[model samples]
Target: MAEVLGAVSSIVTLLDLAGKVIEYLKSASHADDDRSRLRDEISSSVAVLMMLKARLSPTSPHVTSLQTTKTLAAPGGPLEQYKSDLQTVASKIVPSVGTGRLKVTVDKLAWPFKTTEIKALIASLNRQKTLFNLALQDDHLSISLALQGSTDALGAKIDNVTNDLDNVKQGQKGMVHIANSTDWPELTVPVQTEAQALEEKRRIEEWLSPLNFWITQDDTLRRRHKDTGGWVFDALEFRTWIDSPGNMLWCPGVAGAGKTVIA
Candidate 1:
């Protein structure tokens, strides 16, 4: 953990130095296309390093493997190579404080790196940036896999809870019983006569619609043989529709296609 923390701190210092170098290049008195390219490359590398620092930081939610972190921060590793190359670039571009400074005067600064050297440094930074991006992507994949596993586990637990609740509801229904009482007439459930029932059904049908859906359903079922459409219930698509809420299953066909019978 301490090693990772130290690594994070080192990258922070590198980023700061890179920033200074970029700023100095931006303010150079002389304009060179190669110099601008070098500054852009340094800027891109700084972005990559910033991402690495986030992954290594102790406060980060992601748990990057210790081995991976150590490998990145290891001696002569990618980060080290980046630091060495970046410092070389800085020494050539950024002026020193004392007599070692390369400025011809207080206002005019000197450009020391040739076109080929600047191109070489840019190529080096490109390679290091690729490495940093790869590491961050690996961490992203790990986090995604972890979240998927948790979601699967939670779904299983929810299924178990749903089954348990169903069982409890069934048990309660079975426990229901009619108690014996001296006043049996008062306790008895009222039963409507056949004529009264028919009259009530007709009234409801008339109040709702002229067509009687219940009679149509009865006629359809009567014409269908016993268990004629039972195979429809066994279909995988039908089962999935039943399991999922707010799902609709449409069965479309020409006339006399058994659509109504199956439904």
Candidate 2:
């Protein structure tokens, strides 16, 4: 539990740093689109982290249940994964601003142009930010489902144990009933908490409906669009450009040339 808590804390701290980097990028000229995307990604990431943190809080009912179970199950691995992903993103963003790196890179560049290194850094950050946000959401859902399963299993075990002890001594049946009545409420708290967490996850997904729609639309376009045989070379070139670390990909064409479809 301590390890899990520490990992969660580290994720929060790294996300704070990532936010600072995004805020810095937001101040740069002619990068409004990138800034807006970063802002949305950061907002979504923070919201997810807050929800996870609430579930893991010391006073949370979910924590009480975990303590009673004598194990931390679902969230432990996911928290570690999130920690790793955040570390990767921080590694990319932090060094970009360290001790004259940006200034030196900008100074060596030609006049009347923004720093290519900085542009590439922002592109990389945005790409990783999107991937991390998606992974975080996946982990969040997995943890919630695991908690729900654990809660259900614990509830069943309590029922079975209570029934077995009740059968062991008929004379103590009334004592068993009293004990169950006293303990059942506390035992059910975790189950209720897990249910609440699942519901909250649902609510958060609904809140991200617009972003979800955009993702879905982008994926559909990717799948449905294809270049003609005559454009095979162009398609290969476009793929290579996307794979390269160089930032921009400009494909200008006439109005009816199907540029959007190809892209």
Tell me how candidate 1 scores on lDDT: 0.66
The residue pairs in collision within model 1 are: none
Query: lDDT for every model?
Result: 0.66, 0.46
- Top TM-score model: 1
Off by over 4 Å in 2: 64-263
Query: Each candidate's TM vs. the true structure?
Result: 0.49, 0.32
lDDT of 1 by residue, 1-263 (tens): 78788778778888998998888888666657887898888898888777777867667654345645665677876678788888997777677676676443424666778778888888878776766665554332322223234436645655655565556555544433232334454454334445654565556435433434465456455546788778889999889999999999987663234565566
Q: Report the error of model 1 at residue 229, Å.
A: 38
- Which consecutive 10 residues in model 1 have the weakest lDDT in total? 138-147
Question: How many residue pairs clash per model?
Answer: 0, 0
Q: After the best TM-score superposition of candidate 2, give how far the Cα of residue 225 lies from its true spot, in angstroms.
A: 52
Using lDDT as the measure, which candidate wins?
1
Candidate 2 — number of clashing residue pairs? Answer: 0
